[model samples]
Target: MKRCFLWTLTLLVSVVLVVPTQAQEEKFIKRKVAIGRFTNETQYAKGLFYDKENDPMQKQAMDILSSKLAASGKFILLERDDLDVLMAEAGENMQKIGADYIILGSITEFGRKTEGQQKVFSSTKTQTVEAGVSIRLVEASTGLIIYSDEAKGFAETTTKQSLGLGGAAGFDATLSDKAISSALGQLVENIIDKCVDKPWRSYVLSIDDGTYIISGGASQGIAASDSFVVYAKGKTVTNPQTGIKIELPGKKIGTVTVLQTLGDTPETEISLCSYEGEPLDSNKLSNYYISDK
Candidate 1:
């Protein structure tokens, strides 16, 4: 009997490797994202691009970032340039075209430099072009700015000859664009690494005399005695320029732990819990979100 029980236990544990559950199937869902008007904060005028024939420098950077994001396959891309027009054409409401997150950016640097050495016997000329950008992600549901960063990129070319012409190195056609692309590439990588997935969360289903019932199970990755931070959301702010909304995450209301599980999982979530910090003051438990610590 002992041997039979041990064999059955081993088989059950091994089934975990072969049988896929809802938790494994939907641990992370790909999200939709939108890129709004990228701000131009550079000292150079938006109209003063190296190639005046091309669109504004800020527009070019926006297009580059949009293209990269579309190719990533991690997010469903939404068009910001003609959002209202598309909505009117499709006869859809804002809810149908809404994005989970919105991205905003600014061109912080776009300029060129020329420096050289003059000598009786030898002379050299060098030109350097640089571009920098600042980007931030806003949570659409809450209107909160989640992340922000600034990055710079550079491109340089040099010419050297004996008794070189004493002429300044003017702007090259592609130098500025290349530098902007470089900075944008890094920013895209960081966005992919950090913001691709939303954090896992569960809620409080009910509260007893002193115990609590959590709405998570083993299928959702909950384990016995696991610690979690309980948080309630705060006020939201809107961006006047792009109309993107952001919300503050607010402070931790308290902490809780999984004391035991009560039912079958994935469909019927049931986690019993005990307060690890001060207990709930009111019906705030209804609005609380719990995340693993």
Candidate 2:
């Protein structure tokens, strides 16, 4: 009997481990994303300021920004022509691509140069260029501006040697390229860091009058009398280092009690007393989420 019981326990553990492995393999799935055409607003009254042949400096700047954004791994970039074809067919509707989110951006400005003081007796020369860009993310379904940011770049020449005869010399062009690349790379990182996804397993949508709606019902494994903390969707701000942005700290609107559930949607009423002072402002009550605890 002892031998039999030990074997049974061992078998149970083996089954448990094997079952979870199988389940996890089945659950792993990749999320699809699409990057839209990046608009070039860098041109001034004169046309096409960023073309390398016409304007080498601006061309280099545009290339740097585009490449950095592409390297972020946030979305599958769509070519300009392909995107245009899709837009023509779908009339600029993002849902047509079946993407979760879309990135829209414009290069507002770009420049590069160097400037500084020099003392040979008394002489100074400086060259500098400035660039700016704005980027934003929109939800494919609701077209909400979930995230946005602006970044600026300034580059200056950094060379003290000039080529003459067979003498060795270093060029400022290389430094200019590095600066432009670094600034654009940082900007892309910031945008991606700020716009990543935040998923909530449960939610409670409510109004100021103490009435509330709950999701994650019996079908979703939620039960009646289950308590959840309510939160309102708030503003999102960018973090400088990671280039990723996250939602601001939410106000705990109130606590809610699940009164009843119908199918997958649960209807519950909330009490505002749990929050500080009165309930949250009704005007700001756009959406809400539930906590796991």
Candidate 3:
């Protein structure tokens, strides 16, 4: 019986060690991001056959970046390409849902080259494609560019023929897609790091019977009993030299505790929070925001 008891105790200890506690779990808060514009500025693929509004190269780069961001599962990507249609369809509510940051990018450089080597009994041919992309992360609220970066990608394919018996090589159109995808792949991680550099933030949406309805919910990592600090919007000042407007530091006003969550999707999710500390002016809630810190 004593041996069985010891075995049971060991099993219990193992279970406890294997099961992770709630506090030990990793926490990730999703931020809303929008790709404002991605354009092909390169000379490649531009001719009488090129369509400015529907450039294939530009579309491919945007799709690659969008796919990368989506796969990370760290951001709620807003659709900016059809934003005008959405605004017209959704009306006023669409305006409330805004991206925290906007990404404007361009394919600055793109080119292809072919090389060949001839020998007595054998010959080889190579096709190479290279692409360069530049991106700027802009703060939506302040209309300021916070980060800018560039990345390059290269791809090549080689074919060999023995006495002209092997298959001949032609233009490898897929290389363009591969090169662009590689370049954007290098930039995706840096873009994520820049977006999450600061604390996750949300704003008050409304107040119903003293319960505060705030802008994020389960999809954004806001859970019941989660605490957040509310801050008043900082004062904005215009720089005389650059003629740029800058916002000063904001003051901490109060705190809020998440009571419950609402909505089915990240874009529509909202949190019900109970206010504490300093009194908030309901009419001026737009001037305030809540942060994890």
Candidate 4:
């Protein structure tokens, strides 16, 4: 009897630890994303023109944008060519590739200029580059444009050109570099902010006792301690045109607590708790929760 009791205790402890571990693992998962080739939207600018000359400046700009997005740790970037291939393989079902979102952008403008200022005893010269870009985030399934924004900046050269005591004729390389760097940094930051701030929707799988099961996890940036409001079925009405049944409004069920995660699978679990409001219905549930970070 003593040996049996000890074995039972050990098994219980193992089960408890293993269950939570699996649950936590399911909470949040990184999303796979396909960033379509950035189009050059500026008039008169050819597609991929910047890359044609092997311009390091253009390459740097692309690198800055890509690196900033990667740092967010929220999305897996798909190469342009790979996206094409996937689209071909999946055909119309390409949207169902388990991707939560998609990003598209364009470089509208990139131009540099220099100017000079002269005084009786000194002269100053400045070189600046201005870059403009537009970005949009959309739902992979619905192609809904949830977020969009544009950013622009100017970079100045470092070295000042002075031709005379009262005249400056040269460019400042250092100042130009500084200005470019600052603008690039700001553009990248803006893009990251847009991607993470948008509102997204997720589905609820089930509710056992006080626990709730959600469809999103680490891939969707879901974390423990996050709370969500539940909705339940409400009234029903008849459709005037088709004489069909329709739902009126969904009642707010209760709130849920994220207690654990399983993995990046389509179904994940959460802890559900009661709320003062009414429970929401299936239709309402479809509209309420978002997966965005």
Who wins the lDDT comparison? Answer: 3
Report, for every candidate in turn, its global Cα lDDT versus the true structure. Answer: 0.70, 0.52, 0.84, 0.57
Residue 48, candidate 2: alpha-carbon lDDT: 48
Instruction: Put down candidate 2 lDDT per residue, 105-144, tens digits, no spaces.
Output: 6557765544555455443445665666666776553445
Query: Which should have the higher TM-score, number 3 or number 4?
Result: 3
| lDDT of residue 174 for candidate 1 | 79
**Which candidate number maximizes TM-score?**
3
Candidate 3 lDDT over 156-267, as tens digits, reads 9999999779968887889999999999988899899988886777889888899999988886777999888999989989999999888797899889999999998777
* Cα-based lDDT at residue 163, candidate 1: 58
lDDT of 2 at 234: 65
For model 3, the run of ten residues with the poorest summed lDDT: 88-97
Please, what is the TM-score per model? 0.51, 0.44, 0.85, 0.48
What CA RMSD would candidate 1 show?
12.5
Worst 10 residues of 4 by lDDT: 266-275
Better of 2 and 3 by lDDT: 3
Give the candidates in order of lDDT, highest first. 3, 1, 4, 2
Per-prediction tally of clashes: 7, 19, 0, 49
Q: What is the lDDT of residue 50 in candidate 2?
A: 44
Off by over 4 Å in 2: 1-31, 44-74, 88-92, 113-118, 121-126, 161-183, 199-293
> Which segments of model 1 are wrong by more than 4 Å?
1-28, 45-55, 82-97, 119-122, 162-170, 199-293
Regarding TM-score, does 2 or 4 come out ahead? 4
